[model samples]
Target chain A: MILVNENTRVVVQGITGREGGFHAERCMAYGTQIVAGVTPGRGGTLWQDKVPVFDTMEQAVRETGANCSLIFVPAPFATDAILEAVDAGIGVIACITEGIPVQESVKVYSYLKDKRVHLIGPNCPGLISPGARCKVGIMPGDIHRPGTIGVVSRSGTLTYEAVAQLTEAGLGQSTCVGIGGDPVTGTDFVDILKLFNKDPDTEGVVLIGEIGGAKEQEAARYIKRSFKKPVVALVVGATAPPGKRMGHAGAIITGVSGRAEEKIRALREAGATIVPSPGEIGVTMKRALRR
Target chain B: MKIHEHQAKAIFARYGIPVPEGGVASTPQEAREIAQRLGGRVVVKAQVHAGGRGRAGGIKVVDSPEAAQQAAVALLGKHLVTHQTGPEGVPVSKVLVEQVVPVERELYLAIVVDGSGKAPVIIGSEAGGMDIEEVAAIHPEKILQVRVDPIIGFQPYMGRDLAYAMHLPSAVVRNAATIIGNLHRVFIDEDATLAEINPLVLTPDGKLLALDGKLNLDDDAFFRHPTHQQLQDPEQEDPLEVEAGKYDISYVKLDGDVGCMVNGAGLAMATLDVINAAHAQPANFLDIGGGGDEAKVAQAFRLVVADPKVKRVFINVFGGILRCDVAARGIVQAYGELKTPMPIVVRMRGTNAEEGRQILNDSGIPVRLVADLKEAIAQLQQVGRR
Candidate 1:
């Protein structure tokens, strides 16, 4: 159990908003421990007529002993929300908000360098551990199952696509994490891979990457040097054009480093089995695990 | 969002950076007047977002106002093709007329947010007036960078180190550092992702001036900078893309026939790759986003079919927050409104996928719903061959 498990008590930030309220209920329905809700003005109320709502993170943390934070705040105020959770001494934070400015993300990322806390995303689908029954994101909970393969990606629905295929192939996952598509994120492929490397239950890992930055290359270097498990890699955006942002803010080919071909080459050279297309992620991972 | 050189210079000037005396002119007469005001020795540069303007004959040096008018006439209201722009090129509606400087050396300076480093980095090089990518590839040692800690902010010593590394003259090194500091300030204050001064010229008089400027503002930070959002020039963008933007859709027009509409950015790109792998081309890249409602999906469908080159359509949705039923209903609604009969292939999975499949199957519309992505591609290819 990495990042989140059954014992992890969760706090829903911006719980009064439409996205926050909806996802909070779904996460609860998935059997996640919804400890408390935080909405500044809407304190002293009950969310879904069960969980308590607090005006501040400090109050929520003290009252509910919530160890993890799931943020669905809008982009403009999301930075402050993440900082609030950080200040409240939350052990784990997952921000599902999208479109946060890079400046704000960089600042938060810099601040978290020395902290022991783990921040998941500002523009991500979050993570889920089916075995632990701990869902802390907006991902569809049914597609995931408890198994040996650990999955991490830089996308949302794409992760779901890979997970659905894995489940159909009877390859369940230990944990599925989306580090986000933003240029700056709290956790990355290397961070999640480190956790998977140490977990005894995680037999193999599936790393999904795209056309942004050199994080994928860095991950490849890590896998080549230290990772103990067989790795399966998929780098998308082979047909994307240069200088054009492909949907994700970070999914643009700025220079030679951000090209998909370069990332795929690095991963392949690192001795990881590369999935040729998105549809092949499942069978590729299963084949790598069998070896 | 990329702003023209003139707009970038204006923004840089506000931050106390020294830019050459220049004015943007939309007409030949206006260019003549601006050139005359600048002592009649000016450089008429086409104001387009694409680069390689000098090699593309988009830039010309003229010594007289009459010649400046002629240069503007040759550039403005014409498509200036460059290596950055496609072969068709972009329309140049304006020209920047600036006083020509006597340059002794050209340097490059820029502040870009390093995605891997997770901070802003100051990049400086002695090699300038050419593509930085080429310089980076050929002489990687020439590119010197200093990472600025976002928590500590941009420090003077960081800029000083970059300027010193560029090996500037002692007389102008401090001034160059100051300009770098100012550029960093502009980058932070304007929410700009990229702020660059290519060919930061050093004149015989020991003065440093920004000969060219380029700034790319962060579209995600538009809520904070409403004025910067107004700087968007729709004429420089594809009309279909501009239309997609109004409905909060992410779209980019490409040269292909299979129109692709997907729910996520990563999935959308993979769809394009899948189409190409099937020996077909993707007309455009469109992402309806994570939380696509019925209306938004309808808008995305309309935009996809709007491209006349679209021979077939591929709708791939792995529904998470956006239920498959919603996407199917939206597609069915769009197909009715569009009333354009074309081969449509949909591959939907995850939440409420069965209901979505039923919605499309009962919509009285002919849609090829494939359970597997590979089968979907094969079916799409079969239709393309027909």
Candidate 2:
């Protein structure tokens, strides 16, 4: 019942832009179904001579019956692009745009509360389901493989790190989601954890969290009460100095709450085995499952 | 970016939030003149990003202009070591001189983007002279938060809720509500991530004043507010970190031997953690972003090598949107020009890893290319032993 699968038809927002066009082509090459493209004022023009471009999301959805949107618009215009996709009644919206204003995200998030759309990122790598060969966002398509261990993280490259190590350890993934690193992002650990718990193909889960925010703590409580899948967690920025933003906007230590140590303690208490080192992520997941 | 207290107060004043009369002074004499102009009793505050200034001897309440001058002379040229500033204190070049306000009660108020809620939240507390965190840990019942709907903006009911919860008197209830509304307006108008008034004081004369203001404007929204962008102080940050920010590279200095330049922040911190687990500390945290081109790569290499503490460089790039070959080309170019014979452990994964590895192998630089993160960490540890 996870939103992404082989049957998911995708639309590319800002398909005419450099980053958007490049990634859109790559997503298609990786066997993701691309049905439509949207770029204001650049309608009627075909992208890569295959996908049809429309002036607005409404036209794109009406013409192609696209259910999912992969947004790669620049930061300044990303907020409008996300709201536009939501307005057009897209079910799954995954924004790959980085550096969007938090205030803009606030408006988009509040608007999405009443809507049926499941938004992914305002600054994230998006998600990939290897077994179904469905990829959305910017994760490297080759590093993933079809298997049972589900992965969720707050960072892009680190998500790749987990995938590579898991693949190397002979444990493939069902779906890997990067929930973005911004202070205000669409999807959080709890949202994706709930999805993974319901996915029949997913046997276990790997939660890669970091410092900043209480999302991981909340996810820990959810795992304790509802989730029964074996979870191996990793929280980075253990040695990070306070008040210093570690690349991701959300990966900062603000006083004593957003500390990596605190997150580790919470995850461990919730019956999730905490991997203190990145090198031990795959090995620990294998051990946690007794596979 | 974080703006100083004076700048925050200035923004707060413009938004009609009640603040003390103040002006920034670069010299002690200017501070004294400003103090005298503000009346006999004044407060001299060191303008720095870090907190706990009062305990750090950065804030002084003086009765006369001579006392203000003495406080400025003692603080202006000295480095203030606050609990928030870590071991290395920030250098003070300016002070904000303002008229002192007598307090009846100290309250705390702040507006911040609630990350989990994905909305702006207004936080207020009755117990507020101390750190908000302390108040939260010790007396959480005194604190209250209201998440505002961004579309409808900060509603009057929300302000009224806070006023009623904080137990504002009938006389200052409207004033407190207006301050809350204006604070939220400034948060939206200025595109600030955090706008706080610690010790939103209730004066002895029955008036609420924002005694201490702190505002952090979102860097992503800097283009919209050019005036807020100008408030950034490069002098307040490490030179290398400031330089790295210009190129969209995130660099933080750490005391270690291995210098790490990774693709993303999460991976960068994990790389440092992995290296630390292998019994070696990372010298610096340098993330060239996900789309680091050859120019950014070369610049990152130069920045890493500039530090004398960095002995061996560990370059870990996960080629996702950034092709591994592009990273490889950058490494080769930096090594060729710099001619630094530092043993570099290059771990290139994801897309085009084979091509990236080939480029590095052909470069004939003393570089060790490892396939996995574990192997790379082990390799770095061995290099550290050597």
Candidate 3:
């Protein structure tokens, strides 16, 4: 019931591009229903001769009634594509495009304030609901299994690393969402945690955080007060140098605020189980679940 | 894309913000001439990307034009290394010549996107001319913050709030608000990631001027403003990093023996962490990203091998969007061309893992394939020993 499920009707923006075409096919293979595709220049064309392709998001939404928009547009044009999706009334939008300008993200984020929309990422791997067999964006589908734990992360492959470990421990996920490691992202940890809290399938939660930004600390505060589910966390880049962006744009420590130690202390004070290292997440999550 | 102080001041001046009359001089004679025009009392500041210029003697106050020339001669054509700049200092090509102002109080002002809040935040502090981070760490109450709602834009009320919080005198309250509003306008208008004035000084004559300025434009937004692309200084950047950027891959060279090439940034950092945990330092942090094709992988391999300090190469990839076989082919191609004697360890998982491993084995390139990060690190250590 959180974000995406089995009956999610998706529309792929920039469907004519390499990533959009490729990932749209992958999402379909993972049992997600992609109803339509939008590419401005190539309207009335059938994508792979299956999904109907329209010139505009409005046309696609009017035709297919797609509630979700999966964006694979390039970075520079991503802001407009996201706004188009929002304008066309997409309830949930997962933007897979990375390297969208921070200023553009600021504008898009501000625009989302008044709308009833949930945007996932401008640089994220998107989300997957294992039990419902619904996959959106770019995360590999095979590693996920339907179970009781919910996962949220600020990284791409690290999410897979933890999920693979959870699957190895015979623990499956209700849903996994990558909120993106960009400084400004659409969906926040608290927003996802709120959804997971309401989700009956989610018995436990795992947060995969990295160095940089105060999102993790804020999430810890929210968990201490509102959340009742058992939670465990793994924050990477504990040894990362200051003032250096650790690959992700948002994963850079600017001042004393966004350090890994600070986030760890806050999460610990909130009673969330802290995984000492990325390799220890599986064991730590199992211990947390038992408690 | 961090612009020099002179450039930032130019931008600030255009936004109707008060700035000292200054000119950028490429030579000592030019500095002297600019100082002569600005009047005898002037400051000659080295124009470099790194900060802490004053402490490094990169900044000097000159009582006469000859002193300004001597200061310029002492700075220009010399390497200026501050605490911020690494051991190999950045060369000073230019200097800013400006008239010195009478400072009554130095206040801090800037506009930056607060990542956690996902909005533009205006940060101002009473404790200025010092490291704002240290001020924020010691006395957080001194820092005044206002998160701007973009829909309403930067309102005058928000600026007033900041001015009041900073406890500015009633005489300069409106001026402070206007400056704060102008800074926010510059932040948005220039598509800047950061627009800051280190010492927005209030003159004894009740005039406010931006003493030092810094602006960092968003590189991703270069397409929107093509002219801003011209501001990039490749000479000031690491040659390897600049090369990697052409292929859309992120590369940061580190002083270690094992070169690491991974798929995602988080996983790349994790790979570095795992390598360090195994008592080995990483040669570099290179993320090929999720869109790695054969060419990108081959290029990434070339960059890794190009590092003379790299004795061994470790490739850790999680083949989700990027198929493992593509990476395998890239490695084989690069090894065939470079013919370097450096040992290579490969860790391939998900999406045609078996096929990728098979390709590596058949290449007969002596590429050792590991199953996961733990094995990859162990293999790296093992190869590092031999």
lDDT of each: 0.92, 0.89, 0.89
Candidate 1 share of real interface contacts: 0.76
Q: Looking at candidate 3, what TM-score does chain B attain?
A: 0.96
TM-score of each candidate structure, all chains considered together: 0.99, 0.96, 0.96
Off by over 4 Å in 1: none
lDDT of 1 by residue, B1-386 (tens): 99999999999899999999989999999999999999999999999999999999999999999999999999999998999887889999999999999999999999999988999999999998878999999989999999998978888888788888888888888899899999999999999899999989999999999999999999999999989888899988889999999998999999999999999998998888888889888999999987789999989999999999998999998888788999999999999976568999999898889999999999988799999779987998889988
Question: Weakest 10 consecutive residues, lDDT, candidate 3 chain B?
Answer: B229-238
Candidate 3 C-alpha lDDT tens digits along B1-386: 78789989998999999999989999999999999998889999998888898999999999999999999999998989899877778889999999999999999998899987778999999898998998988988999889997667899989888888888888888998999999999999899988999999999989989999999998777878888877777666668988998888888877788898999999888888888877888888899977789999999999998888888888888888788999999988888987557788888887888899999999999888887666776788899788
**Residue B327 lDDT, candidate 3, scale 0-100:** 91
* Best model number under DockQ: 1
Stretches off by above 4 angstroms in model 3 are: B337-340
Pairs of colliding residues, candidate 3: none
Cα lDDT for residue B207, candidate 2: 88
Q: Which pairs clash in model 2?
A: none
DockQ of each: 0.84, 0.77, 0.69
Docking verdict class for candidate 1:
high
How many clashes in candidate 1? 0
